[model samples]
Target chain A: MHTLALIFPYAVAFTVPLLAASLGGLFSERSGVVNIGLEGLMVSGSFTCAVVASRMETVLGPGNPGALWMGLGAAVVVGALFSLLHAFASISLKANQVISGTAINMIAGSLTVFLARTMTGSGNVRIVLGFIPSDIPVLSGIPILGPLFFTKTYATTWLMAAVLAVAWFVIYKTPFGLRLRACGEHPQTADAAGINVYRMRYIAVVLSGALAGLAGGIILVTYSGEFNGNVAGLGFLALAALIFGQWKPLGILGATAFFGFAATIANVSQVIPQFSRIPGLLLKAFPYVVTLIALVLFSKSSQAPRASGEPFDQGKR
Target chain B: MSRFKNLFTALAAVVLGLLAGAVFMALSGSNPLAGFYYLFRGGLMNMERIGNTLASATTLVFTGLAVAFSFKTGLFNIGASGQMLMGGLTATAIGLSVQMPRMILLPLIVLAAAAAGALWAAIPGFLKAKFNVHEVVATIMMNWIAYWTVYYTIPAYFKGTFLETESRRIPALASFRVEWLTNIFRGSYINMGVFLALTAVIVIAIILEKTTLGFELKAVGFNRYAAEYAGIHVPKNIVLSMSISGILAGLAGATYYLGYAVNMQIGVVPSAGIDGIAVALLGANSPWGVLASSLFFGILHSGKGFMNAMTKVPPEIGDTIIAIIIYFAATGVLFTRLWERITRKWNKEA
Candidate 1:
């Protein structure tokens, strides 16, 4: 196999979670809520998915694929429900967006660890339903793409690709997208135009949570073999990707892929002689270095929504 | 009355946070009163316990001051952990390499740590001021960069004899512990770090309350465009503000790695950095408020272990209880509004 082929699988795995989570951020930020708690949401979702899948695996016999999907579904619901706290704090209570988001992070992280300790008894949770690849029927026959794209890939990758497509359409072409963007850019004007700005924001935030939850689920069943009560700052990295992507779905895909590619190189450096000479720690830090440089280079007038972090108040304007 | 609202809200938050923890303790099948009693008693049982609690709080004081200072300037310094790491790493690097008199060497190492931390934080501050990068994302990215920097630096330079995960222990001369203070505290880890923290508190209080520079920074935080209109040099102040915040956190790192623990550990951002935000929020971002809250948090962190040992509740549950307190504390604005509504209703009835 070509070197790129070996690296492609892991890169795709890395891309899936970051891309999904950033898409979640895109939805929330586009509707004017800054969802910094994406990390917490991802963590809770990962734990929920892992625990559910593990229990189901025990009952349904090992290697049952349906159990994985069921876990993913549960994760989506849990993530959204968890995020409602953030939505309520930031919206109705008019709390500081940053504080509210971080509070959610603290609560989610500690709560999951506490529950897992009580439920699992060993203070950790792991699942044995691993991601083993099977070749797609005809797509596996394609020349260079066959081995790289279609061989031994998990079903979750295809699911993410489908999600990206739908997300792009929903956020770009749909009427709902227009209203969401309007809510973020100018909630007062959006309200004047008969858009229910608050309602739109709520929907956008909830949708973001659902997608982020899916990202967490994908990470557990694919990238990492076990859930460790951590998405390990992937949520924050996703936020970086969201900002880097300029808060557009297509741009987020590109940004997340770039980060995913950096992360893949870091983890696989021991196998590649060219990268082997560099310290392993530097390689681990490579993605962050890349992110910082990208931020510095592109930090100009971040095309963020004008009213991004402010609470919308109809009375004030 | 509204002038004292922030203080009132913070007090309410602390009380509510404790109540929430008590509720969790009750649910966990432990007596809430006993839990509270153990929690406080562990921190105040003896001179040694008091010393240890204060020693633990020493880092929180600096990190809280760092966060609160940055909050005043309208920037979120999420990279305080990274700054702390850099400070600790620099101090450790100095302690490992230098052979000099204690008086000269200590101040030199402390300055080096502060400079490194300030430089680390200035990157995000500069980016935010010059290019419009959001500090939250940029600082988080900086954190990983700092984390990896320590990960690489420690093993390459000061690897311990047994543990690959931490640096070699600092010699006694470079250590923050003084023989007299340790004896006075009955062999607790208490050191001169607490004094350093107190001095920092006073200096920061003066800076925030009595200086034009502080006023400029606060104005910029309140409204950037308006500050710009007032010719306050907003960009300069942003960088300066972050630099100051970083310096404080770096001091924390000095006390933490050099004073609290003899060796620096790899692959973990200091939890004190995030907890600092809660301390600042509960403190209402005042210098003295931050100090008070840091001490409160210190007791919770230090006493948590004993609470677990005495009660049936696990360590994770104890940590969760602390998290619940922080969550409620950070949601001060929500409670503030609630407080305001109740007050209005009371006045209407009266």
Candidate 2:
């Protein structure tokens, strides 16, 4: 019981970025674009967030609360802008989406480190402040659930949870969501029905970019508090969550939470008695191994949007 | 001829990549011309630097070939990095523990590395063939698994006295770095690995172009259904193609760990694995083309640090340039149209 409370906040903190990124992936894959570049987009966002937060520190003074929010906003904008390169190659040039995404990953990985080195004399930008966890006013008074969920929670955790709820509502209940699904399912049919397939896809990819960037920002402002050139494959893990969740909002929420808990436990296991019995290697490899198994299990009945990786052609049958 | 056209496209991509790199340099407030000058000179101004360029190209040559080989069978072997780690680990273990003559020991190390890499990749191949899982995701998972395995195994079994992050330096007899080869390169890190890479290139070229297996793999790549209709076993071919691809990457690991550097580091996923994708792309997935592109990339990589020291340009500019080239290569169709327009206009003017 004590361990649960102690582990809860850390797990939620880890899950937020992944949830945001997986949700971002959900949007792109739902709209017929396979966004393998989420990792790169997140890195770009993280770099932008770190730079903005660190720069804001000088102007607004250290520990100014508003700086982090501003940083998250900048990350979103930069991520959207950077994703345009992928959008152009995959959508306009009709290049292979996987190849374009790989290029994006390489570009983001190297360019951010290159620029960061130039800016900070090292390829890392450390911010003076990060989001502090706080208890919800009345919610903290609840029983077991409150202690685990509300007593020590990050603002971003609630923000992401809210985003997930909204995503579910929008995806299932809205006209826009219906059209988006139609475009992904049958872009030609959508075009025949007078829906603009290209426009819908562009919007979806860009939204994914923005959300992925926000995920990067969330990582920075939460536990990380610094921008290293790499996000240590969290974006890829989020991608795995996207697969594990079967492209559903609630499904992703569960998947990310599972991964988050696994990661958090692996990280703190040496100090904790219960987890120490497991080999460190097994703990580290657990999430990835599980994801691979999940992939195999889900391959036959894959819920992947039919046209997710296909380049939409209006003339195609 | 199509060969001429392919060469032209690759050259055009290279130019565009350099221009993009220049744009980045200008954005960062550095002189692009000075950067390029120093970069090329840094790679070629001395004998040792030239040797270093070849040494750098060695691992890339193997990895690029690995990617190219898998690509020939319509498989994306992004797991080359993981395979390299497994191979490197195996080679390192053998190098440290074995007692034998250099000639016999080196071949054994290479064979072990190759087997390890092949086994690692065969799992993904088996899964892909059996269950229809995406190789990209499967290979990625394999990469992380290999990463953790190495992370734990090295420290537990073969820790250096000084650093937990790296294995002990490989003994001279087990290394690819022959004294004669080192002296020939004027004390650069160049080794017998260069000869191995070249020999592998020739051998792979023959296997790909001359063998019945090559025909089957290419047939599957072009149209798997058609190949199956013609009595080829698609799953078996897929597995075989991936295993062969893994062999090259494993050899790359042996060269990288046992040849390029004396010791293996624990945490790093080799950038050469990713760079191999770039090499294969620019080379048009041809073995000879991979050799050419890897060499060019080697120059850029070897020159990058010197350029950084000589000018304000960061070493990452080389990687940025390679990435830009890949992006351009991915958009090859766009370039072909643009090129066609320019040529048509020139013909009209003529």
Candidate 3:
């Protein structure tokens, strides 16, 4: 029970970001733009959220709940706007998607670090917000389930779950979903069938940017409660989780849970007797190792979208 | 006409990037002219700074070569970071462990580092060649593995003290330093590593331009189907190209550790692997081109601190500049095509 207790918070926290990013990835990939810049978007979003939330605390006397929402809104807007760079490079310019994506990653990384340093008057800042966990009246009394599912988990976790459910429905059950998938499978074919491949891809990539940004925001306001250069790499780990989940929303949820569990173990390993002596870095490396193994095993069987990383060319097609 | 168009396109990208940077500076309330002045002066003014630039450029040279080698074979070797880390660690181990003469020890340490990098990169190369797995994701995952493994192993097996995470310094005999270069620069860390990097560029140029193996690799890169039909072993060439690329990346780490730092300390050495990508990309993934690009990047990096010292601008402005430069460089060719099309359309109308 105690072990479960130790693992659950991390599991919930990890899922929020992973699910959001994976859904974002799905949308973008479905619309035929492979978004390797998801990590950069997340970092930008995290920085925006942290800075906004901290500034709000300063302005609103530290106890305003609306500060968090404002930060979330700021993150989404920043994320969406940044995605425009990728859209312009990939969709409009018809550049190599990987290179453009990598450029975005570099730009985001430098810009975020620069902004954070400038904003905080130092290299680091603690983001303060007024969202403490308040128990639901009747639901709070349920012994194990309440704590595991509801009581201690941040509102973002529930939000992620809702987002995932909506994503699943929108992606798999709707007409727009069919068009998006068709665009990924064969953009020329989709175009011939009267679909706007460019517009769809642009929308998908933008949505991905927004979700990645939201994930970044959640990490800042909920889990770490601070923003630093460390969080920049989490988006990459989320990318790993996206692949490990085999690019499915449900699969990604499970993969994130596993990684989250590994993260929790690494975090609390010092408390555990036998694992304490092992270097914490090695334990921390577990999820990456698992991801590598999973990729090695499944890559042969995995079927990526036909137009995964290729920029669409109307004339060439 | 095509040459003129290409030059114009490249100039336009440079102009656009500068404009964007100027806007950013203005938004941040900094004087753009003062910032550019600091950047230009810091990078080019004095002898000590030039030596510092050369030292950093030497490291970038190896990384650039590594990236270019794989790119010529039509592979994006994103695992260069992991390979470089492994190379550095292995070279440090050799440098610390060996008691041989300088002539033997220096080459041996470098060779071992190259091998370590090659072995590390081979995992992804093999996966991509054998299983048709995308190298990008695999290489990225490999990077995380290498980083953590190196981080963990460094403290566990090579800890020199109870408190410090760094290993013991390399023995003096195994180190590579140029006395003349050091004298000229008045005791800067500039060494024979720059010559070695130049030699590598020459060797890569020869191999890429003059060899049958290079032809095979290029054929595979140009079109795998055509290469296979031409009786070239596609998978073998892919693996070999990646291995060679990895070896160069590793050699970069080795040179930095054995010739420059003389000690392997976690988080102290900048990520030569990631920086190598920028160097390679900016060089247009050409061997000679990479050499020139690396020198430019090295100058910017080495002068960043000097710029901060001389002016009120932060060192991160250098990173911003580098990022913008790389972004423009990556899309420079595309911009050229767009420019050509626009010019042709105007010419037709006229």
lDDT leader: 2
Model 1, span B238-342: residue lDDT tens:
999999999998988988999889899998889888888888877888999989988988888778777777876556654565566666666667767887988
Model number with the top DockQ: 2
Q: Chain B vs. true chain B: TM-score for each candidate?
A: 0.95, 0.97, 0.91
For all candidates in order, the CA lDDT equals 0.86, 0.91, 0.79
RMSD of each: 1.8, 1.4, 2.4
Q: A1-317 in candidate 3: lDDT tens per residue?
A: 76776577767776678678777887887778888888888888888888888889888757366788788889988999998888888888777777777778778877777666666556465776535655666786789987777667677777888998988888889999889888888999999999998998999899999999898888887877777754636677777777788767788888888877887788788987767998787787778777878887887778567788788877777
DockQ of each: 0.68, 0.85, 0.58
What TM-score does prediction 2 earn? 0.98
CA-RMSD of model 2: 1.4
Q: Using TM-score as the measure, which candidate wins?
A: 2
lDDT of 1 by residue, A162-187 (tens): 99999888878999989999999999
In model 2, what is the error at residue B91, expressed in angstroms? 0.7
What digit string (tens of lDDT, one per residue) describes model 2 on residues B193-217?
A: 8999999899989988999999999
Model 2 misplaced regions, further than 4 Å = B342-350
Candidate 2 clashes between residue pairs 3 or more apart in a chain or in different chains? none
Candidate that beats the other on lDDT, 1 or 3, i.e. the better one = 1
> Which is better, 2 or 3, measured by TM-score?
2
Candidates, ranked, lDDT: 2, 1, 3
Error of 1 at A37 (Å): 0.4
